[model samples]
Target: MRLVPLDIDRDLGLVHAWVTHPRSHFWGMQDAGPDRVRAEYRRIAENPHHHAWLGLDDDGTPLFLAETYDPAHSELAAHYPVRPGDLGMHVLVAPPTTPRSGVTSAVMRTVLDFCFADPRVERVVVEPDVRNAAIARKNAEAGFVEERQIELHDKVARLSFCTRGAYEMSTPHLSPAAIEHAHRRLIAKALAEFSHERLIEPVPDGDGYRFGELTFRARRFPLEHWVVDPHSLRGPLDALGFIAGLRETLGIPEKLLGTYLEEISATLAGAAWKHHHRRETAEELVHADFQAIEAAMTEGHPGFVANNGRIGFGLRDHEAYAPEAGRPVRLRWVAIRKSESLFVSARPEEDHYRDELGDETLDRFERKLRSEGLDPGDYRYLPVHPWQWEHKIAVTFAPDVARRAIVPLDAGLDRYRAQQSIRTFFNVDRPDRDYVKTAIAVQNMGFLRGLSPRYMRATPPINEWVAELVSGDDELRACGFGVLRERAAIGYTGDAYHRTGTSSAYTKMLAALWRESPVPMLAAGERLSTMASLLHRDRWGDALVTALIKASGQTPAGWVAAYLRAYLRPVVHCLLAHDLAFMPHGENLILVLENHVPRRVFMKDIGEEVAVMNDRPLPPAVARIRIDVTDEIKELALFTDVFDGFLRHLAGILDVDGVLPADEFWGLVRDCVRGHAADHPALAGRLDLFRPTFRHSCLNRLQLRDTLQMVDLTDQAGSLIFAGTLDNPIAS
Candidate 1:
């Protein structure tokens, strides 16, 4: 596509038709004739601050019209503060002769490129009419953030701005350059994580370490953490080749080797996609909104090399569903026969449904059910991921649909953005609404992300138990720590899969859970950020933690201690006080930031993740959380999951970013540990948090052994593959 200056004499007829069409009502020129359109363009062409261009294809046929102006000299300058390098733009695609998939977006991006082509333009400003929902989505895809709504002379307009960097990140063309960039980063991560897992040890070389065919400089940190310098990597730089070459040493089974490599390739592709998008610097992200930080996270799981397998997603699916894609999603609703489905909740089921779906939507659903000759009260409404409904349930459960056991309903009113955890979604349309976590049947990390029906029955009760425990504990309340309880869950069991009695992803499909949102819990002047953001580093190697510390007006040590008080203190209290431990990894927690410092942390992903290590008496419905394990292995909850899995990466990040030294970081962690023990004297010796050595639980090893079923959810400790031991960094 090429941009040609609008020719008044030649393109007058075309431009006049476009602006005068009923479909172009938003353009505010429906009454304009050819002469009027020509005069308008003539004035725009004559003005020094304004100009018009015609976007043409290779054949020189006009496809779109674009106008660019200096915002300082336009109507927008009056509404918002206009910066020196802000360029105003407007684009309209020619009314389609035949509809195309991405024609408007293509034209939109082209216009952006044309604006950014000039180095003088630092940011592009747009003011599309508020009612133009299609253009709003397009603007969001182009990385334009809405600043405010302004009442213009003609129409109420949404004022938005997009920087050059943002534009480039949003429309990252999947070119050779992007692929190469992705490969380099993935290779670095593979080398670092695999080496950390002790899958393939790299011995000391000249300035770096040497493995089979790779050489990279790495600064070894505590807990066997290897910070491999991405720039120092010297190897084939092929993700598949890297994984395939280490197949023997990694002990990947022959049958699963191909799938493992496919996961690696997919991870690389995802890395590239993330690498291309997210041009915001760490400093810029310090003040970004919750969803922005969620979308900006590049690393899926810091410990896992193939963190973003997303095996079932194609290019289009990635755009529509991937968290990093920053796309809003509407959950598809399905009605299932009450006999074949289980509904569990802390609140009354009807009240829960009424609050979530609204009375109007509930009535609509009931009407739809009655129209199909099915009684509404006999069925339960369950939220289904659009992808799962189309790809899995629509076909695989057709028999159930035929019997009116599973009936499809319209999508919900709220729009949600996929959380970093992939299966969970944050409600973007209404922040206070419950987060809907749905089963997708997509393979991510080591497991197929499907919610088990039997397990769903106990979810709400387990959450209730945990919430009660946390509330009753003084230490947790003092630290301002809480759980985002899984309030409700609904699971549908198809007749065919129910009879099989075999454990498989098929049986676990078509379930959804609603977890309480942390947004409502936040106080005024406080904001929410995913705990994962602390470990996030921008493309330029600036750490978000460092930026956050700077923003907080606190020293590095002060910031670390504050964060530990909010996060680590509560985690340790839970273990010592109740023998209760959660998967307290970064993504599982939401950090409440007050003036950019972590004030409190909300733990989420309850039910399926929280484990009670001690043999404690429990209610039958909540007993699923209790697990039997030897006393010695219990603190692995703290040592393995918290210390090794989470803080190890955070320590490395802060150390590498030069904000805080690793030794000092650990010293602070040790202080937190001692403080917790001091506060709870009777429970200090319950778990040996200060043990000199802890078993080195290898995550990749488990995945390598069985990619399909990595861990037995019932027997987590039995499923772990421990290689050796790591010297405890926080042991005193």
Candidate 2:
């Protein structure tokens, strides 16, 4: 698309049309009429630091609207850190089509080309509304990274930045010359239809100059003897006569109409009502005259007046008058001298009147002005307060406080349950069933460890049941099984802990089963081997045989190898004998510990098992295996599962309850885990190995540090050392 300067006359209408287009609402232009549109373009056309243009597609159709602001010259200068050669920019796709496919990125590239082409320009910044994810994504693709999310101009805007270096690095192939050419083309088109004129006289009160009948001034200007009558000729005398006729015809109501006419005459040399063929045509002629006058006055012709249907100029150096009681004074007759000047303050009283004008009329008037090629920002007639107008461009960056509708977790759980039921009933005898079951179990363990902590303190009730069953206590087992059976029968699995088969579920269930299963002192015994084999055929026999030898406290010797060979498949035996058998249990132990431990595991329950292993005189290899497995599981329970789970739970609780101190809960978990691990040397080693992994995982999951506090675990090993703890305290 071609990028060219905006032409106040020719391109004003198009710019206005784009701005008033419903899509442009986000860009901050309300509906405005042609006259205001022209006024806005006039303002921008005269600005040296701000540049705008219409971008065209290859087919020569207008594709997007692009604009750049030198932050040093704009209000954003005060808020954003401005670089001497930096520019702030924005791009919007026109309607009946929004940005399609890569259009936004294309437009952004074009804008970047224009901005960065100037060797002096060092960076470009964008502040898109955080909720405008599409724009944010497009910005990222255009090589902008989020610097921070900040409140700018009363809106929550995501402030993103692209430095020249980063942009060059990310988009080396983009052509700066091509972007400049497009910008030049757009600017040239916008300037082509612009009207320039000389002032007739010096305006009063050092307000600049007067062009035609309109006087230009800072912030405001006065409306001259301008008449919009359907029945008068174009001369001053006729205009005066038209005014007299209007006073008589409208009956002036004797009270309100006289003051209005007197005020009009005082501002204008003479009052007149002239007849044009149509009301709209006459209004345009009056507005055009005002525009001509404004252009003549400003030093750079950087101003224009908008009449739209209103017939008065804004009073210079005078606050808008608040009449005690009467027909409302017509501010529409007021004209803004500088397109960039802030409008009259929209005080409470004025707002009542502005609102009464109705959104439709205001929208139409705004659209008409924009259609005539004006930035909505240039018009002073909009009802928005002066403060609101000053930050108009940045307003789009504001945060949308409207809460989005979120599907609660309960609903997600229900949907997961339904899907799980369908999968179970249909795929019961599928060849991958065991694999799927193992996968499901692993996923359940993860969820129990991850999600359940957020819902309840201690182990969630459901996890407690699972722990009871795996710990092999008859009363607890029966009770847990009864609950499970009841839940299954009712088709109400509480929260679908076993249903959806997510990664979290797998991790949680696997961890819980490993830690609590009563088959061996450590989960990696013959029973676990059998179970693993039933679940996964590829790794079954070897896994079983290895677990048996480990549990029996025997080293893999001649007989053990033969037994393994007899039980496992030939390929499995060969692979295990060669590759797997020599691998350390520490790594495997860590993996199993991560998969099986729930958020909370009772230390006393596992202490008895560790004691049994310590008393046995197994082979050095087998003894090491037991020590590593026990240590890893216990350490994971204390460090990773408990610590991380507590933090996640605290965050969830704070979000729901609104007043809980997360630090207190985190401290409690840390203290409990620290004490438990320190008291057990096997657990201490596990904790140390698991600490780094847990920290890394937590960092990845929680994007913000304020969401979860990190405990000081650096001195933990030193504390354990002071206590004279060793890897295997029982051996000493």
Candidates' lDDT values, in order?
Answer: 0.87, 0.32
lDDT digits (tens) for residues 1-732 of candidate 1 = 679899889989999999898888899999998889999999999999999999995346789989999988988878988888899999988887843334676578678878888999999999999999999988997889998899989999999999988876674436577777778778888788888887777889998898878788889899988888887878777778878877888899999998888888888888777766556688878878899789888788888888899999887688779898777788999999999888888688899999898999999999999998889999899999899999999998889988889999999998899998788898887889999999988998888899988878999999999999998988899999999999999998766887788867888888999999988998999999999998898877788988999889999999999999999999988887888889999999999999999999999888889988877899999888888888767788888889998999999988888888999999999999998888789988888888899889999888899888899998888999888899999877
Q: Model 2: how far is 150 from its true place, Å?
A: 3.8
- Which residue runs of candidate 2 sit more than 4 Å off their true CA positions? 97-100, 171-732
Query: lDDT tens digits, residues 614-694, model 2?
Result: 243443312321332243433333333322212232222222233323343333333433433454445344224323332
**Candidate 1 TM-score to native:** 0.80
Query: Which candidate's lDDT is highest?
Result: 1
RMSD of each: 12.0, 37.9
lDDT at 681 for candidate 2?
Answer: 42
What lDDT is obtained when candidate 1 is compared to the true structure? 0.87
User: Ten consecutive residues with minimal summed lDDT in candidate 2?
Assistant: 409-418
Query: Among these predicted structures, which one has the highest TM-score?
Result: 1
Tell me the lDDT of model 1 at 519: 87
lDDT of 2 at 445: 7
Which whole-number lDDT from 0 to 100 does residue 437 have in model 2? Answer: 10
